[model samples]
Target: MAQSSSGTDGERRLDLIAMGRAGVDLYGEQVGGRLEDMGSFAKYIGGSPTNTAVGASRLGLDVGLLTRVGGDHFGRFIREELEREGVDTAGVRTDPDRLTALAILGIRDPDSFPLVFYRENCADMALCVDDIDPALIARTGALLVSGTHLSRPGVFQASMKAAELMKRQGGRVVFDIDYRPVLWGLAAKENGEDRFVASAAVTESLQRILPLCDLVVGTEEEIHILGGLSDTVSALRAIRERTAALLVCKRGANGCVAIPGAVPDDLDDAVVERGFPVEVFNVLGAGDAFMAGFLRGWLRDEPLEQCCAFANACGAIVVSRHGCAPAMASWEELQLFLDRQDWPHRLRESVELEHVHWATNRHRDYPELTVLAVDHRSQFDDLLAELGAGTPEQVAHFKRLALDAVHQVAAGDPRFGVLLDGRFGARALEAAADLPYWIGRPIEVPGSRPIRFEGAPDVETSLREWPLNHVVKCLVFYHPDDDQEMKARQDRQLLRLFDACRATRHEFLLEIIASKHGPVDSTTVARVIDHIYSLGIYPDWWKLEPADDAPTWDAVQAAILRYDPLCRGIVLLGLSAPREELLAAISAAAPFGLVRGFAVGRTIFHEVAAGWLTGVIDDAGAVAALAENLRVLSDAWRTARDARQAA
Candidate 1:
């Protein structure tokens, strides 16, 4: 079997191979405004072939792009962007002689976006047949070539060669009548305005390639250009006469139509016009996104109706957001959008939709977190006694005030996270769900009662009931010298918890504490971690006390990586240590990449809690005090982390 060098197991087996234009799009960021007055712009990977490749990849497809990029910063940017999205760039050639193409797009309104293409002697247009790798084409399930690239002789030959190779190797050909007339040198103005003009030469070139394609996709305007007919029905008939490929007509807002083989005698019988009505922002990349969705369903052998639905959803999502490639939705995001069922209207304001968008767009890897651990049960009792207020209502009020302090500290900072519990922090946890900060819910009860989880009877049920955004933090107190039977029981319990976490898809943070029964040393911690891994228990994050030294932290990190390289890294536990000491420990750990951040508890707000209970400070004073301490710790951690990264 033919294979691409970049493919896994040395087999080509690509879901889609795209050969055409690849460029950077500089989109104006000013919404509800004109292009001239736009103050800012965002850069995104653009072009029909590139957008399709990225969109399909986002939907979990193995895709590759075959194009040329100038050996410049923009070219590097394009390559990196594609690589980040899991698009195979092995076929992306770099030309030292030319510059990468760029598109300056301005959003004047939803219906009108001004665009100027800077592709005169651009690297992508210089694509040659020599750059075509026949083996790679053969490995792909489908080879996609855009109409713009087909307009030029050099790129046209490359696209033709790729299609021919793919057909000979039993791969399907997908032709996107992308129809960019500005590239044909027919639409030029002194002010760099974009215009489209239908010409016989353009139609002839497209028709020559149409018969070789197994599928042809285009918008109504694109079809008019290809078929040389103004009427939609006439255009479909003309296109059917030239190619036996499946035809897909993309009608913005009104949905799309997909016809198998030639145009049916009754065109209405073949058309599928289901689509989500979305508030259009910029319609530039919606077609490419639509193609991506259709291809995802088509390649998966889904029903034509379902494929059109996916296409429409994808197009709706892109049109509602900014940029092209970056605005494409992942499968999870798309599913959430579909589940809301509030389409053809303003659904962007829905919190559920926003949550899905944020979660899906967040980085897959663990982010740098400054977690504040305030899951104190006994500490609250001590404060209540000091204040002489034991009523349930008063206790709840105090807890609410403390949680408000934490919220105040975390407000405006996305890096901040908090660890709360169901006992005293239940209300806080509920509130945290609506906030942007990460929330860690503790599973283990406080104190050293042989490391029992709080609410043991409902541990599994509670974990299952927890929100998907929350992390489950399990603190286990174990000693190497403990009674063997007791140790075995604890191990069993931990294994059960780990399995439960895995089953529920909750990220686990294992907080290991070496009891007085064993030497509280780094070696002991490392042994415990190794033993846990041996039992097939790997956690996403490690919550540990400050290591005795830098070497101790290094040893712990080494063991963690050895067991699970993908571990989310360690966070230093406060253990009620003095503020100065905790800060020092954090500074030491901050130098290591394996140390993510700290989760300090009492050190931050213990004094404030005491003061508030004794009437030495008001509620506002307490909140202010906690915020100050949090800010100090957050700044210290950032400084240390930034310095280490710089070094």
Candidate 2:
């Protein structure tokens, strides 16, 4: 809200640099359960500065995180998560001596959240003077330092060095009073839930850096600890005396008060912005989210009132949801939330808002795909039966060979993928996870007309164990003209599966085989897709049979876009067609751009698997043959794509 002429340099790369902790958060999934009784936990990126970095990035700010994490998988996870959120990670250093910080949190009630910090000698705390990059501090337009980093002497010096460098460059310095007494050793190490435990040392340390800050944000308790006074107004006055920095006092449900000038004698006279009144589910990372939202506007020189409104709305949205960083809304979603005056008071229950969140926050892009579909269950069993000597182990090994073929032709390629099932290809699935290929797993029963999930009685429970990167794929044979009862049952099953994927944050791929129920015309597939979308089920991907003509592809694209313009596009399916015919279909679909690529299964794998099972080929021979077949198809798709682009 204040101008700094030195910060207006055109060469600065980032708008804000968040300097502090970077770590992982494991939140208990079971609500109303004690931390000791928790059975499962959901992993998310955490730490106050990390959350603020992600939040600011989501709201369209060019932000960078300046912190350290351990040289471990969890540390790599933090850096990758920040990068995915569009935050620059050039300043994210890896500390080899200590592990990354971890926080285990659980929600027992609306008012009670149990937290335990495992940050002793953590990597972030090991941030020393050498980690501070003077060039980075000079180039940033603003610097935000969380108070937790200032608790220990070593990191406190690191924080102060960055702040002083930013001050010397005339860049803005923001202070988020992220005080936790347990982290400061003022409370029992086990009591991380305690937000406030005053210490004269903590107060004195904060007063030392107050003069350098351009803006200071804290809850009432944090302000009290900073100003060394018990009264809110007196604390505000005392803090005002130390620095002319604008103070944003966060008042948890009521709203926040921004005192840009001197403290008013009466608390009611402060400039206040009202917060959205919503049902609070968990308030763990709401303050971090608030700071993120505030900076989204603050760094852009927006009005302080507008900045506070954005901050309050963001905090409100996260408190009504689940984990911290993942719960932050995208800029588009936040605007929609504010524009809709009659929105459902419960933000989580609004389908429109949830869809916006899902669509906007998805950072990965798949412009094209070439996937091998080896997830056919009953067909593999039938092949084994015809061989009369093969075991399930052989099928599993053959599946692995298929994966090897995929790797040979398209290793490290994001466009190449595999669609395999856990029934017979469990070993193959395990091996595929390490590669950079697009991995999809099927859950549909081989050929249940009304749709049934394999392996588990409750599909939702089974999905909890799936890796977040694996897309959930389901196949159904349905005709628009089917009997009403049968169609309704299939619709209900599809809805349930889609809901499960949404709940678990997995992408959903719906494969429709309309020809199985009746003869398919050019328009038949498009009609079935329209009917499904009419039922309010918008899947992330649509896998369908390729159309013979341009008009048919046009009809399908129109139907998909009419419902969800952001759909992940379609993938052409191969139903055991001849190689020549499949190539022709690829050439036809290539020009449309709506068809992403192809998932041709039996066409490429059937002969190789059959030869391997019947003793006509060894494992190496089968792998080579499968690789050759897939290579031909992949080359054909590329040629078609090139030809279309040239035309």
Candidate 3:
């Protein structure tokens, strides 16, 4: 098993340890526009070495990053982001004298992305040999060094020291010739450079460290500068003569070629080509992603061809997206992509590949959530009809009343989320989108005969029209003993919805209620849950009914963990029970760590909404009653949770 550097046993077994640049990248949100006219920017953790480390970590590798960042927010942001992605930050140092590096990037065209580097005496470039620990390098299986750092004296010395330690310890030294000419004072501006004026000084500096690397990777143009030859074949030979290291050439879209050191005089026979065709979006971080993928396979002692293929796939995926580090796919997503028959084919432009990438890599940090479910349609109609007021105006008024109640309960709390539907709560749902709270909107009609989806004719079209930030809350009444045809139909419907949610990057909340056809006990619920997982549909949240006992909750929790550990904890659903009964159920479920919180709608606001619709109570009265119910339940859940934690 691969051990992380920060393991408690002090066992220093890391898959890969990288040393070099780390910075923040500010990306322009406006596509097809120049950087000057862009209005908004999205911040991402940038820098080649940092991106590679993050990519490898996401691919299930235990990696560590060694660099320095300023004692500022950007530095802290970089550290937090890396840690969140499972990269070891034990070697990351803080320097108070300088600011962290910054890169301003703009998507000017499909092939051109304008970038400005602000690294004048930046903290990352100020790395020193003393900052690198030789013991740390010895513990890692491989040490990856970025080439741009070698252009500067301070970082160059540090890279050399790290390489020396890795070589001395019998570990592999992988050198990524990440050539950024502008960073080395060779180019006037920061942009893509295919070739630069190769000076003796540049060649001598690169040659000094080339022989020390066990493996060297660079583009055709990068190899030109390293070998002082413009012709790629001649350059490959020149670099081969200088060092016994294996050479890997990066050919964008065309794939890559690997030449081993033990090859005979014939270079063509020894060269192995591997790659997949993909529509290029931005080629900025493709190389870094390739390096990460290659290293993942390389460290595991996989075949050279397999490593090259993996590298090509990683590169292809990143180039089709917008950002670099954040766009890298997880191991599962990569496998899914590769398993398809369309190895080199591109999806349509309407399909945002970034959505799938983001959805797969999304990190779950919410250990506990308090959700207020107000997605009641049929129940609301019944209440309004009982009051002799079943008009559209009355329904809209009732929805507003519910929204006001939710707002009152969620005013001072940041952990509150609301589940609203489109039937009568469309306006409320729109208003909830503007609030600083987690919002969940329903996709299935409240109580269709066989549970029909709302909105467009198909689930995909409906999801495409949904706001990206809102979670797709799907309620299904499924029983373990339903007829084969009915079960199969619902199964196919859910599978389609899951695929749509994943493709469109919508967080899903699957609310499952056992149908009245069968006895709905904890065992039946667990059986239904198991059946859902067996179908391979994983949702972000599971809104389930409260279990009767600790063992029952444990069974459900075990099923969820067994199927998908990434599944967020379960939230209790109200079955239109009384407020006191719902509170009791929440208290019983709150002790289980897997039960995060509750999503009780009718119990909290059904009576209040009815009174407001009948004009028996004023708007303020309804709001007060609804708010009190929500607060009481929220307080009860929290108290039980805190007590369980304390005990």
Candidate 4:
């Protein structure tokens, strides 16, 4: 068994380096629609090597990708997506000369999918020898190169160079026979769905690098093309004649067979690790998923049987979901699936499976937050009415100043964030767009009893227009003891908002103010969250009125951790509490790790905002006042946090 080395600090070396294409996959949303007739598509970062790299990272590998994308918006998107998935992008370069690649695919039926590639000299194919870093290659435990990169001259040289570097460093070289017929010019330009074509030139090109690989993987058709033979066993033998690399043949639903030695006369002479029986939704990226799962075990020096099991389960899961990279399972999700005694044929329909996927796939971490809660629409309107001299425009400007105060307190720090609403704070939201603030935009109409969205009749449709960085914040005023009808209506709205957030890939912060509906104790607050969780609503963050006792915070924390351990920690809401009370609340909750930080609006900015609106203070005076207040609260939080850590 081969294993990767570790540094003196005990962190393992890079587990795998994948070199090849990176592109955007536009998967047609209409299940049975043709590519020409499909009106909507879901965009996901894709390409064989790219998907494999993301999948490996999800499966807990220190993976990197060596590819090139055009200096365009899609290029930046590719790099960002890879980084979000925890893949090292040091080797992913930008090709100024070429555009990024794209594939437009539609599921005509489970078996008959249509695809058209837009790769007329794509940037990924422009990956040259200049892009291959020997030092980067030497740090990897394995180099995995796809057949698509070897189809072109420049990319072929680059891939070969990377493979040689890995081999020189005593790292394994894994080859994925990612054979695409149209890519090799063996099919019509529109025929990107065509998987294989027999070409002597292709066989010779692949054989040139076969001996360089320690492990080789391919489907039956891909093996036929690689070996220039029609029969699977015969092709395996022919490949074995050319190289001593271990051969793994993917047999789709029938699972896979691994041949560590000679090619068997009959495939049955080898052990076939069976795959999970899943109803296929789209099979376009299953092979890449299989490769990812196999490498997850292989890099850990797990046995071939275990590797095949991981590979088969991964392929099965991806086939039951839409898109490629997004459908790839996390290691925890995989464990849940394997550990379960019964699974639905359509894995996509499993709520538990989808929840696990949603929870674990999120790469962003908000360990602590000190956010300025300026998302008060109704409160701002009341304030304007009280002042009688301020316009909506003035309130909007006030929100912008609040954002500035936030900047003054903690500029360039992600832990500090803002909860700004679109009604009066739209300008503030726009200004904070380019900043590193963890912006949370409100959708719930300020203080709606049953939860009505402000401007969005259709929440999911409206979320499509929002920037991906903006977390959706919705506040529901409800008691667990509310009337059955009201509870049902509120539950429906929250569920709809949650589903929309999931669809749009936005983090959700569910703010509960049960005191608005009825007398609220700490236990009542905990019941509200537990009740929501029981309804299968797992929000990324919870915004609750500050509780000054440990028991209440403990109960709330236990409920959250029990329901969704991946739930992003809670943030304390101000609710116009005085400075001393808010500080006490922060101090009380700080000892428990679940209480992340405070989003106190009134305590930090109410006096300043009122003074500014009533002409009692200048903009600089207002900014200074709010900034100082925020600094004090932040200092208190740090002191409590540091005390907790020391204890």
- On TM-score, the leading prediction is 4
Candidate 4's TM-score: 0.96
CA deviation > 4 Å runs, candidate 1: 1-12, 189-195, 363-647
**Per-candidate TM vs. native?**
0.60, 0.94, 0.68, 0.96
Q: Considering lDDT, where higher is better, how would the candidates rank from best to worst?
A: 4, 2, 3, 1
What's each prediction's clash count?
2, 0, 0, 0
The true-versus-predicted C-alpha distance at residue 417 of model 3, in Å, is: 9.5
Write the residue-wise lDDT of candidate 1 on 1-647 in tens digits.
01234445567468898888899998887776766788867677888899999888888788999999999989998997787677888799999999999988888876678777788799999999999987677667889999988887888898898888888888889999988777776676323344358799998888889878888999888888889888777888999998888899998898898988667666567868677767877788889999999998998899988889899999998888778887788887888777776554665555445435544543345558887778777777777777785554554555567667667877756677888877777787887767777788888777644667766474676686777668889888876666888788888888888877755557789988884456776577887888888887778789987864877777788888886665778888988888888889988888888888988888987777777666788878877888889889988998989999999
lDDT of 3 by residue, 1-647 (tens): 12355556576568898889999998777878878899867688999999999889877789999999999999998998888788888789999999999998877776678888899999999999999887778668889998888998988899999899888889988888887778888777655333466766777788788878888999988888888888877888888887888899898877888888653454446666656666777777889999988887888888998888778888888887777888886887677667765543553242334434554587545777887788777777777678786576777766777777777988846578888877777888888866766788899976653668988888887887777778898889888888888888889888898888976668889988884567776677778889988887788889987665777788888888887766767899988887778878877888788888988887887777767776788878987898888889889988989988998
Colliding pairs, model 4: none
Error of 4 at 599 (Å): 1.6
For each candidate, the alpha-carbon lDDT, in order, equals: 0.80, 0.89, 0.81, 0.89
Candidate 1: Cα lDDT at 611:
76
The number of residue pairs in model 3 that clash at the backbone is 0
lDDT of 1 at 420: 82
TM-score of 1: 0.60
Error of 3 at 68 (Å): 1.2
- Give residue 592's lDDT in candidate 2 (0 to 100): 82
